[model samples]
Target: MKESIFHRLYDTYHQDVFQFLIYLVKNRSVAEDLSHEVYVRVLKSYDRFEGKSSEKTWLFAIAKNVAIDYFRKSSVRSSRTFDAFDWETNQLVSPTKSPDALVELNDDMQELLLALEKCTGDQKMVIVMRYFQELSIAETAEILNWTEGKVKTTQHRAIKHLRELLTNDTVKEAKSHESK
Candidate 1:
């Protein structure tokens, strides 16, 4: 039973957890390593899982905690590693694509990514889980081990901050274009 449960969770939530960690950390390699670490911790704590929450919720809660621990231990260093996948990559496509389409896509992607970078970690996690990962509010709260109210507040703040960043960016771009 224990092994079956572990297998089930591994299959069900592995990809979601990986994607979540990738967005949070903004690095593919770190996300992959942390995803594996999350599972290891989950396996060790599997026996301690009481029935207080659903299995999915419990697993995500563990993942969230692992992410927090990772951030706590990690030091922020300037690195160009993740820049390979930055918004500019979205502009490049096969010969089949039109130049206008590429330009529009790149502009939109750049704005979104820039806005995302401006968000606080707490706000970013909420946005990533809820919007990017498509988790429900309850599930998000469960994963973050936060109250529903807290989740809602974080979501609001995230959106507000993102909007401000986008607005400011747009103004700057317009001003630069006008100057040119």
Candidate 2:
């Protein structure tokens, strides 16, 4: 409730919460709006926070719930594409590559993001949390309020689905090239 504690929470967890919301909603603007809402709710409920979970994990759980609420209220999904560049690295996946090679790598990463879009919502969440966000399985399970087994199963299935989607895309591209 205190302004200083609220500011501290925003400073510490805003980026992580925003990233999770962006992955969930697929829109930066919506994520930004939702990030504000997450903090607002956190401020309102701060006194009730029992501190059973780490603050970061607690913030993510709130973010996930806020995203779900947005989906429910709007009954529409944002079609914004994922930005595939790693935020922390501030460079493409392979920085040492030549310009053309870097472009190719970017294309591949974008294609992978598109493939991820094809996954079911739960699978997508599991993949983003486990791989993209680099959260541990236990942490992801906590965020999703799922049992660890459920998180593991969803992660396994998501990976399998991603492989299939990427392989199919590669085949389609190859076929197109062959025809060309």
Candidate 3:
């Protein structure tokens, strides 16, 4: 009975939970460990789930908290690294060819991800939840235990910051290519 319930939850949300952790922790093994910890916590608190939020939101809330705890405990610097990024340019491209186009899209995504690294922690959280994870403002606020206004404000600032970073990076890349 317990096993089945857990399996169901895992089947439904494990990938999302893992991706959230990976975004927060910037480490795969750490994210995996943290993912396991999230399920453990879910198992412990399964009966207490009040359905106030969707189960997905509830899981994300737990994941956000678990990530907070991990950060508090971790001594390492929070310098963001996505050496193990898992992304496909499916959404950014058509069902077309042209290897050059694919490479350009990948470069653009790389630049964007790198820009995300430069955002403040709040900005990063807001961007990841609101954009990367595609959570609604209400859901993002709930998971972060913030007001919707705060989420919106942070997301706005994050986008502005990302735009600045990407613009600068693109100019730099262009100048470097021109020099070559």
Candidate 4:
């Protein structure tokens, strides 16, 4: 019975948990290992799940706790490094007609990723889950075990920070292009 429940839960939420873990840890291998650990823990604790929350929300809560534990233990090590791209240089050298013409907007993506890396773990989690993963604000709040108001405030701050980062990067890129 426990095994069946575990399988069902895993089948239902494995991808969501894995993706959340990846965004949290920023290391693919570590995220995979942590994701497995989360499932194992959940299976062991299945009886404790009193169904106060939706299964998805409960699972996300577990994932968030697991990530916190991992970070606490590995506080000394650098979590991950984001490489920012030189957009102006890339635009000028490449045959692409204009920076705006590039699909996926790699430069903006890189800047956003870098800014995300600089955020507090809580801020980063909220931003990634809400914006990047497209989870509803209520869902993100439940998953993070936070109040809806707190989630909204954190998300607002994260977006403000991201906008600042992007604006700064764009200005720098323009100035560099003008100098060249």
Instruction: State the lDDT of candidate 4 residue by residue for 33-126, as single tens digits.
Output: 8899999889888899998888888888888888776765554243344333322121111111222222344766656766676666667878
Candidate 2 is scored at a TM of: 0.80
In terms of lDDT, model 3 sits at: 0.74
Instruction: List, residue by residue over 87-144, the lDDT tens digit for candidate 1.
Output: 2112211112222322445767646654776677677778888987898999888877
Each model's TM-score? 0.78, 0.80, 0.77, 0.80
The lDDT leader among the candidates is 3
What is each predicted model's overall lDDT from 0 to 1?
Answer: 0.71, 0.73, 0.74, 0.73
Itemize residue pairs with steric clashes in candidate 4. Answer: none
Tens-digit lDDT string for candidate 2 (1-180): 389888998888778787777666665677788899999899889898888887888888888778666754454223244444222222112111222222444777767666766677678778878877899999998887889999998889879989998998899999999999
Comparing candidate 3 with candidate 4, which one achieves the higher TM-score? Answer: 4
Instruction: Please identify model 2 stretches exceeding 4 Å from their true place.
Output: 76-105
Worst ten in a row by lDDT for model 2: 88-97
Q: Model 4 — which ten-residue stretch has the worst lDDT?
A: 87-96
**Strongest candidate by TM-score:** 2
